[model samples]
Target: MLASFRERFSMLAAVLALGVLVGSPDARAETLVIAGDPWCPVNCEADSQRPGIFVELARDIFGEAGIQVEYRVVNWARALHDARKGRIDAVIGAARNDAPDFLFTVTPVSHSRMCFFTRSNSRWRFTAVSDLGGQRLGAVKDYSYGSVLDAYLLSHAEDPTRVQLAHGDRAFALNVDKLLNQRIDVVMANAWVMENWLREQGLGGQLRNVGCRTPDLPIYLAFSPALASSPAHVELFEAGLRRYRADGRLQRLLQRYGVSEP
Candidate 1:
């Protein structure tokens, strides 16, 4: 009976070893799906080699922990909706006001300086929310510029003459086109995002940032509130982020994308 028991234990060990060597399905890396609009420098084209800062950071951090990240480009509004329903795992470049219910990392990945842009030849300036009146303001739909601006935009949403809201992943680009064509007086945009767009499109001198809203806000990598794994995922990301920040890897990564740490 002792010899028989020993033989059974040896057989069980061999089977377990075979399972590991053969790549058992149970041991495969967990995959997290992150989706958002093409908010470049934050998150960019999904198929691009360099994708975006947050996307790459998630991949790097999760990849090191036996996890895989898949990024997808979708309209911001839909991305938020899907994340809420658990169709998508996470959203990047999200402001707190953008999705208050979503789980957010304690550490901010970057900051957004909301600025108003106008044609280089135009003289319109944005000094206050009141200044936005009498001017056809261009903005993206479902985006939170700030508390004051958000209130203003909400109030003027139905008034096309007061505000022209663009939708979809290319909303920012469309707004810029409107500004350049004299269709809109001023367009609200993120300073860093505008800088990246102008640089990429070679339209550097075509427009100028007249003024910016005060109190720049931090953006984050937010996860679906409906996902059971969200808590663990956020914890993992937070730990990895702290390590990267402490080691200067975060700063270097930002620099590579021509972005300054916020």
Candidate 2:
């Protein structure tokens, strides 16, 4: 009986190894729920025909590893909160420091160039965090402008009068309106997001960048600790990313959405 049991265990182990090697779906499907901040051209609401570049890229990468990826466009703040609380599996189109505790994949999924926007006639440039003191600034609620800007927001918690945090689908238009009316000195947003929205709104010719641009930060796929993923899940996803890039899938996907090489 002992020898029979040993034989059965050995056979089971061999079968399991073969299943993994052959890309079998013997393992349960792990649905990696990723949240995006509805940034146009890169990541936007899922309803958009071009549901952002990261959407397709992430889906294919994880699919290769037999892991399912479900994307949802939600308020950026809610996305972060959900990920932090382990209610979601991951967040895409995220900066390196956006969620420091999450496990970041090896390669960056994309890049975001952030800057300040103002009326063409205004001179409210964001040279430093201190420069924002006592100035009217319009920013999206729950968004981060790197460490410097984030720190400024934290330190000035007592004086919330300077920043107007908009929370609506028309947030971009609201910021533009405030700036054009001199209600706000400057508005902050991702450069790509600003350009896309401006073009969509036909206000591209009116607004100008203050050029206090954050160097294009590499965006990544970060997994939450509460994610029901194997310890090797991150590694597998990274490998898939590498393979996708090597075979030129990433570039093709970008081109498919009319995005140019950065």
Candidate 3:
């Protein structure tokens, strides 16, 4: 009986080894699906004329690994939702802690500074958080400014009416149009994005930066919890990222996409 058990175990081990050699689903065809918003300059875009820096970096890294990568451009809300559901493998170029459902990678590839924008002629000067009190402010929907800003706003719950959220383009347009129509007081956004949008919309001359939150926020590539469970893939990605950073390739890629070092 013991001899028979040993034979069965040996056969099982052989079968497993054969499976690995044959490239079974568990070992073969490692495909990673990444999602991001194209509207944001650093992440995603529909226009082939101008691709995002983060997308380019990811493509190069995965290409080196001989892994297949699929990128999907979706609205910010849908991207976050799908990431939470594990319907997507990863979310690229997201602000750390932007969503509670996803786990962030330890290394951040880029950073963005949050700033307040207003009409050049506006009287409001944003020196502190209190300046936002009793004033309508525009911000991208579902984007976290940071913990300090979030906590400050939450602690002053009585000023709920002071905050107003809008989608990215809409929020930016609102700021422009508000200043034109005298509707809102200020609009908050990442400095790069705000500048890009302003220039794209031909409204750069009409806006001015009032003040900005200190300590620029870093953006990270976030993975769904499902993907995080696979330690192998995580290590692979980190290794690839480290290689890119070490060779100055990462910085060059960012510069190619108009992302200056912050």
lDDT of each: 0.84, 0.71, 0.67
Best by lDDT: 1
lDDT of 1 at 190: 87
Q: Residues 164-234, candidate 3, lDDT per residue (tens digit)?
A: 65554244455557655656677777787777777777876788998998788888777777543334444
Cα RMSD, each candidate: 9.2, 7.8, 8.8
Q: Model 1 residue 112 lDDT?
A: 87
| Candidate 1 lDDT | 0.84
Q: State the number of backbone clashes in model 2.
A: 0
Q: Candidate 3: which stretches are off by over 4 Å?
A: 1-30, 152-161, 168-180, 228-230
Select the stronger candidate by lDDT from 1 and 2.
1
Per-model TM-score on C-alpha atoms: 0.88, 0.79, 0.79
- Model 2 scores worst on lDDT over the 10 consecutive residues at 10-19
Comparing 1 and 3 on TM-score, the stronger one:
1
Name the runs in model 1 displaced over 4 angstroms.
1-28
* Per-residue lDDT of model 1, residues 42-80, tens digit only: 888899988999999999977765668999999999999
Note the residue pairs that clash in candidate 2.
none
